[model samples]
Target: MLLEALTHTWPWYIAGPLIGLFVPLLQLVGDKQLGISGNLRHLCSALLPRRIDFLRYDWRGAGAWNLIFALGTLLGGWIGVHLLGTGEIAISPDTQASLHALGVHDLSGLVPHEIISWEGLLTVRGFVSVVAGGFLVGFGTAYAGGCTSGHAISGLSNFQLRSLFAVLGFFAGGLLATHLLLPLLF
Candidate 1:
């Protein structure tokens, strides 16, 4: 029963409140901003040893725990897939219908192999969605000063106006992608 629970999804009502609690917990424990994207800077600082202004900080002092968090995320994902995964994945009927309408036939994998594989990557649809979309995500995250998780969770918790604007922009972009760009590509 425990293993079954581990392999299954959590109800949003339960999961959402737990995730929401993280912000206050983090604030109480340490006055640190919770964001995954900022860890990249700390990593670059350690590896490059450059004299760049942004990279000049004592990354270990400030972001050692963040790096550990990143490591744990990676490890947890591996453990989940290898030790706890049930091989079958669950998707909503509406999502499956939408994908079908978009010409996706395979629903066996986490992502449609027809659109995400090496061969599929050379196709225009795959190239645009995977490569170009990835670039846009990275660029947008930097331009906004943080990722969606940061803005929606930590920044909002601290009542930052910039984060509110960033979250709105994120919603707009996602709406645009889902309603327009995604249909055009797929």
Candidate 2:
């Protein structure tokens, strides 16, 4: 039963609450912020010379737990994939039809290889979808002061108004991307 549960996706009702509860548990344990975007800054600060103002910080004191958390997340993903394995993503038939119409036939993996593979990267559609999309996400994360997980989970749990606005913006951006931008790209 435990193996079955570990290998399959949990329903939102089960997964959502677990993720929601993680915020307080994280705070209760160490008062650490729940975010992944800051890990890049922490890593750069640790590796790079302390000449740049942004990279010059006590990253060990501020983000050691975050780094450890990131490492644990990576390890967990490896274990889940290599040892436990994963069930196929259950995309709805209607959604699959829509994607098929957009020229994405293969729904075998976590993402569509048509849009994410090396050959795809060299094409205009792939370059715009992957490279440009990644740049926008990174820029938006930096601008919003946190990623969706941080703002939606940790920041909102803490009753931060900024996080509320950030989450709203994130949703709006996602909607725009899905409806308007995705069709154009695909």
Candidate 3:
């Protein structure tokens, strides 16, 4: 059934290659760079019109397709959660044990609610993880000129040196967060 198919997780081999194919497909179709961060500038340009020189161009010409792509992503997420109702994330046993060692006892949801809820957000550890971490991610994305998906997938596929450095920084940051910061907080 359609519902069953929607609920089931696609194998990484299938999903990975499908995602990998997007770059060439996009290049063939329109020679576009696939990235969500650029869409923010387009949206701003569309809204503000002429106050800022950067926002003066016709966003519709360059970013209309991307806007539609963003809308489709939102719609797909809605359908996945609301209609398909597939919620559980399959965490590996080793990863689960590692999380348990890190004082995370709950794995009922996609994320451990004990560490991510409103009550948790009030705690020092939660505040740092949720609030500070969010700020860092946003700031880093801007500083790097794009996000992980943009750099790792699209830019890397195109052999961009900037993206290569950005991806390396991302990995280093992730390692630091997991090995050093997470233990101190939790």
Candidate 4:
């Protein structure tokens, strides 16, 4: 079941690659792909941004399918946590030991909890970070002519070497941010 998969086996490394696989399959079937970064354009359209791009696409021409999909995602996530079970992934000792090397131990902020609840996964600080990060990601995706998923999934599937490079950059940027920058900021 989806709930079991989420609760028992979901991790970024696992989900990311599986999703990277799924996106291309969807693209092959629908001729369209998925990415979270583009949602900023939706938010921008909702806010009447200086650049009204999401509106120009006429997503409504899809008969509000986008809206339905949005609702489904939200509903599905809630069901996963509430109906199936709550998530509390235990961080690996390797991660904690690495944090130890970074002068972070069990200390607050400097060190993170080993086990994280779904809500704890989205603390106020985390939420703010998501908002700011989302904004930056939106800008980057727009500038890149496609988001990470588009590049890693749709573009890469066609053997576009550029997508491979972009994916590498994405991984590099994430490592730099999480390992180096985030600790400094927090």
Candidate 5:
């Protein structure tokens, strides 16, 4: 049933809030606060050669669930890509016109060129972009103490002011990086 929902009925509207509600409920029930960035600190503590910082909590306690979540995400993405079909990434007509105005004549070819290709994935530019983006996200997640979803959906629903600030900061930082800094640097 879950797989079917993933394949069929799970639109953004349903999936979005369901996730938001689930995270805090997990926190309420399990006594573990949810945040993606916290995992970075958690992970670093577990892997560091010298151990001095961690004196309170056990990293191993979080490991199993984290691994399971990681696996689920990987599996879901693969299924979404391959089995569920790469449905058109919807954008407003106005947004499409804006891309056209920006001299992007065709916005259709912008993603997943003929599905997941090893050649594409292994290409130096692609590999570097993925690695660099992943690294930055890791750093950001650590800095923010959560991913966008954790704050935007989970924390916001719980009426957390900190999460609101984090979400805003996330958007602001992303806009700065993508709009202002990325073209200059890349």
Candidate 6:
């Protein structure tokens, strides 16, 4: 019964409040910002033995907890999938049809193999979607100062005006990508 419950998706009401509570809990614990992009900077600072001013900070002191959090997230995902997952992606029929129209026939896994597989990586569409999209996301995260979880959850809960603007921009960009860019790419 516990495993059955773990395998199913939680309703937004239950999940949202839990996620919302995480911000205050995080603040109470460490007073650190919740974000994933900064981990890249921390990793670079720790690994790259360069005199570059940007990567010269004491990332160990600042981001050790964040690094641990990231590790836990990865571990949690692995456990959820390997131990608790039902091995079925429950995409709506309408969504499946829409994807099929876009030539994305294989919806067996979490992501479409048409765009994420090694064979797909060699295609122009895949190249643009994966490589270029990754570059744009990294650039956007740096420019915005945080990713969605950081800005929408933590920053907004803290009542930061910058995060409000960032969240709006993120939504607009997502809409544009979904409506305008995806059809053209596919």
Cα lDDT, all candidates: 0.83, 0.85, 0.83, 0.63, 0.65, 0.85
Q: Which has the higher TM-score value, candidate number 3 or candidate number 5? A: 3
- Give the TM-score (vs. native) of candidate 3: 0.81
Q: Report the C-alpha lDDT of model 3 over 1-186, residue by residue, as the tens digit.
A: 976766777679878998888778878999887787767778778887667776788799988999998898899888877777755778799999998999999888656787788999988888898999978976688678788668999989879999999999999999999999999999
lDDT value, residue 75 of candidate 3? 99
**Candidate achieving the largest TM-score:** 6
Query: Residues 1-186, candidate 1, lDDT per residue (tens digit)?
Result: 977886777668987888788777777888767788777778878888577877788999988988998898899778877787747667889989998998888988667888888888999988887899878876788678788668988889789999999999999999999889888988
Residue pairs of candidate 6 with colliding backbone atoms: none
Q: Given candidate 5, what's the lDDT at residue 30?
A: 73
Pairwise TM-score winner, candidates 1 and 4: 1
Model 3 regions more than 4 Å off: 1-6, 40-64
Worst 10 contiguous positions by lDDT, candidate 1 = 80-89
lDDT per residue for candidate 2 within 137-174, as digits (tens), equals 87788678799678988889889999999999999999
**Clash-forming residue pairs, model 1:** none
Reference-based TM-score, model 2: 0.89
* lDDT of model 5 at position 48: 77
**lDDT pick, better of 3 and 5:** 3
Q: What TM-score do all the candidates reach, one by one?
A: 0.84, 0.89, 0.81, 0.65, 0.68, 0.90
Reference-based TM-score, model 1: 0.84
Arrange candidates by TM-score, highest first: which order?
Answer: 6, 2, 1, 3, 5, 4
Q: Tally clashes: model 3.
A: 0
Segments of candidate 1 deviating more than 4 angstroms: 45-56
Which lDDT value does model 2 have at 169?
97
Cα lDDT, model 5, residue 114: 24
Ranking by lDDT: 2, 6, 3, 1, 5, 4
